[model samples]
Target: MTERESPFIDRTGKSLERPQDQWPPYVIPKEAIDLEIERLADLPAPNNGRRESFIAHPRAKEPGLGLAPGIRVSLSVLKPGERTKSFRHTATEVNFCIQGGGYTEVGGKRIDFKQYDVWNHPSYHVYSHVNDTDELQVRLCYSDAALLEMMGIYIADEDPPSVKEEERDYADEKNRTDPRAKNPFGTFQLTDDGAWLMPYETLINPETVESKAHHWPWEQVKEHLDKLSALGKDYVGRRLYLLYNPMTGRTNGTTPNFFATMTCRPEGIVDRPHRHTSAAMNYYFSGRGQSTVEGEIVEWKAGDLMLSAPGWAIHNHAAKEGTVYELTIQDQPLNIAMESLLWQEDLKLPAAILGSEAGFGTNR
Candidate 1:
């Protein structure tokens, strides 16, 4: 075999203790984003009718260029009366409309969304965006495309078929009659310690849970969020609500890979320093704030986007004035699913693997 084909490294006795390369916190000011939106708006419309830009971190590499290690954020804009071509991808997404209003057609369903609305796109579902109104539409889309790209499985189809054929019910006729579908030797316990042996027939046919798109309008969410301010100064927990999708189950995410939370930080409210294995990015829309990330203070105002917390980096935020409304996207669900979500709710306490252990609680 050629030397290029035999790509193997001998590490029989090499030292395993190597420092982790954690990315530093970064921020994209409102001005930079506004300029980019203007620039995109000025450009001639592309053939696909989609004008988008990826927000890459300074330390990010080609395989997974994203603002966070596993979370990819992209800015998309559409002119009035314009619409994107039909497209589908393996990576699920959380779409947030930051400016104007539009509607998205996904999986034969139409979702009409306004400014500050949040919605999820299910995996492998063909979708397209339309701006039927007179105003320009701007959106921030967060996805696991970066992670999928790193894994060499980020498949996207720009020319998906305009009409998807009706799905056949496998369990209705053929599966019920097929002898191979029924396993004579079913799964059974093999050990007292909970070990079990599953037949190949059973292994290939796992339970299916239908995943659907859900929308949370900002006005509806805001009404509920504003009530949390009454929790007063004595409340210890953050005032936020996870835009949960039931399909994620115990993972607590908007998509399988990420959780999007809308936070309401009352004036002068400060959070206690905490750390987690999942990286976090925040988009502040309504007020100014400062985040102390890894001992470095980073100030931000309304319309700014920030990489508030790198994985496992201690961080905290304080509202400077008025009620601060921000949308935080974190790769917590992926970590939790992997049983690697180490969360430290308090600096003085020990960190615990969140999904696998007893998690921390706050005084209500």
Candidate 2:
């Protein structure tokens, strides 16, 4: 790097540029693993009323595999019959259920969650999780929690919510900008028993009633998953975009801070390189595969995770000729919202990438 690009500088007017290995836009194939659960189980509420953070603390240790300016991913697990302490939050926590089944209590509302379900805990809301089942429950959480804390705008209240569900003093639109309250997709409402109130919507006025929590049920998602895993299919992209909230009908399910989608690379297919500014953190649900991140092969299997460094990493995917299913989280919506999303595809690979060997493809 040149003088301006050097990271280290002193009064000598010279700088030391770190090695390229330190540079990001690379992959961290599952920086976190099941080991986190064992560690957390030894502790107590949501955090065991404690916390075991994977991300580094400024005063303590070196940084882990992560991105800059605010994107972060972490883990939280609760043993069966364990519950987290209730609190009003200041962090944006979006969770993808890694395993186990339970419900989360948010603002006096109940959200039933199961394996592979995606949900968000809104900022400035009262929330906690309850594991009622007989197995270990893990949550793959993504958020800008550390970012807000680092910026000095962080807000967290240990106090519980004083207002009951029936007594919440909310305006017609509690907070329009909050994705939870916005509810652009579905018409739902609050009931006395903490159940959702699903109302009908009219073309004239789409906003009728809505609920606080949103869930993408895996039961409903399984049909699509099965259809994508067909044998020798003539037409298939093997990728599913998890946008469009079924309730709200909005094209996206996530907030601007993050968006997640699922893709499947079936047996014997090799994908070409593609790049974008939005870094992708991929969680492997099932399959065996290897990714070439800028020529760095990152091999992964079921239950592992990987990252495609943001900003121009030539990444390609291939299974050991085996089936692979990937769940990816990226800040693509954020970049697009900020008008900074760029994408590129490698021109060298033939159309065989998507199993389109005939050189025939349909735009639709």
Candidate 3:
């Protein structure tokens, strides 16, 4: 094969061969992502009247990235004073606010939201994003659209009965055990003993049952916020807030398939590389920075979305002069619950990268 031929494609044989290295962990640099999204902002909405909906199709012509099975990450960019016409879909969606603030109407109800607010849209729930802010509004949204599409059940439209409402219920495994019960709110699951999560079926005391919500407002959970700096300089520090579920004391995500997190990389800090099975859909919330994924340097600025797909590469994060705030939605929580979350860190680096052997770890 020529040098320009794709590593993922096997032109030598009649059958296709997908080499792992060819699709090695990669990044959707913020620049290209923002460029596409900004371009979408200026265009007219489809007949559905969604002002601008941006989804990074994982299977692009170039070497694309998809962090996990059954997951699709997208961005919804709305200009000032714009609102989307009501539409519905069969895919469950979790949304993270990246820039500006707005309100959304879900199932005929109004939800006022702001930056860092994590929200959800249940399957078949009629919803619309209403951005009244003077500035452009950007959001990182993810869903199991790929899975639904594969099953031939995915539907998105403003029309009626593309799918039966009952079919939607069967598609949603919110309770996992109860197929008929509708999840009017957020859900939880237990993973480990004395961990943030516990299995739901094993609990003995009904009175002691804990529950987590579908949405977590940044202002409300500010006190529970933990910073990576709290670990001292000994740890390659980054500041992040976890959305926890009060129910199982485990991860608080909109759905069981995935969860979200917010991290703040201090100015000039370079975090070490780590490899894991969970894919992370990353958003550059603020400031400027870069991530080295599979030896590819992906530079990004504020409002950029980068996807670090699972099993692809070792990912290291770094920030420029200013602190970089980031939002990451990943399948880590689900892996932890299944007791199969495998990960490793490469902390030992050259003296030049670590500054000094003594500077590598804190004095703790």
Candidate 1: list runs displaced more than 4 Å: 1-15, 166-176
lDDT of 3 by residue, 56-102 (tens): 44453222222345567766788888887767777767777767898
What is the per-residue lDDT of model 2 for residues 37-146, given as tens digits with 9 covering 90 to 100?
67777764443353445542222222222343355667777778777787765666677788898998876678899998888766667887888999888887777665
Winner by TM-score = 1
Q: Rate the local accuracy (lDDT) of all candidates.
A: 0.91, 0.63, 0.63
lDDT of 1 at 66: 91
**Model 3 stretches astray by more than 4 angstroms:** 1-34, 57-69, 79-81, 155-157, 160-213, 218-238, 245-252, 336-340, 345-364
Each model's Cα RMSD: 2.4, 11.5, 10.4
lDDT of 1 by residue, 35-125 (tens): 9999999999999999999999999998889999898999999999999999999999999999999999998889999999999999989
Displacement of the residue 224 alpha carbon in candidate 2, Å:
1.6
Which candidate number would show the highest lDDT if scored against the true structure?
1
Indicate whether candidate 1 or candidate 2 has the larger TM-score.
1
